[model samples]
Target: MPAVFILLRSLVIRLLSSRLAGSVAQFLRRTISTGAAHIGTALRHVWERIRSQESKEAVLGCVLCILNMHKKVET
Candidate 1:
């Protein structure tokens, strides 16, 4: 009876730990994807501005502002 209780306890612990780890991994993956999307969008906007022959200084300023905003959001 003692051995059976120990086995059951161990099994429950293992299951719980595995579930916690999976949840953490999923959260990190989602966070990374969101950050990547923000950067990609910023870059695309900058590129479009350049292609449109917009002022270089203005484009640079916009990109910098976007980066600053991203940094703030991440923190």
Candidate 2:
């Protein structure tokens, strides 16, 4: 999850500073920030669920999911 966030943030920064300009750049910034905020909220909910889950296997699965998130996004 952290890796995914880093990848997304880097992409957004690169796009905002390079290929985007004027109102389009501002729009993209706002859109990406809003989307990131929403994802953060969702992640908090997921964290809560993971904490409440007592099964070791379930927790491990969640960890694995996060670790592999970047790979999934790449493809």
Candidate 3:
């Protein structure tokens, strides 16, 4: 999935920069910043801490709590 993002980002930059000005380079500086739909490696993250193990555990805990399945999830 990360590979796919890299390929798509590269392709977008290639095509846009070819027909546009250097302003197209701004695309690289853009980031997703928020939202679950675009979570993971498909987009650039502002920081690794945003998806850290602690955060993952928190999310899993919330999901389990919501579903009333607060049981051990074996890793």
User: By TM-score, who's the top model here?
Assistant: 1
Once fitted onto the true fold, the runs of candidate 3 whose alpha carbons sit more than 4 angstroms away are 21-75
Error of 1 at 30 (Å): 0.7
Worst 10 residues of 2 by lDDT: 50-59
User: lDDT of all the models against the reference?
Assistant: 0.85, 0.78, 0.64
For lDDT, candidate 2 versus 3, the one ahead is 2
Q: Give the backbone clash total of model 2.
A: 0
User: Candidate 1 — which residues are off by over 4 angstroms?
Assistant: 51-75
Please give the range of 10 consecutive residues that has the lowest summed lDDT in model 1.
48-57
* 1-62: candidate 3 lDDT, tens digit per residue: 99999999999999887867655545533443434346544423433445688876776676
Which 10-residue window in model 3 sums to the lowest lDDT?
A: 28-37
Q: What is the lDDT of residue 2 in candidate 2?
A: 100
Per-residue accuracy of model 1 over 1-75 as CA lDDT, tens digit each: 999999999999999999999999999999999999998898777677575455766777876887688564545
Task: Order candidates by lDDT, high to low.
Answer: 1, 2, 3
- Cα RMSD (angstroms) for every candidate in the order listed: 5.3, 16.0, 16.5
Root-mean-square deviation of Cα positions for candidate 1 versus the true structure, in angstroms: 5.3
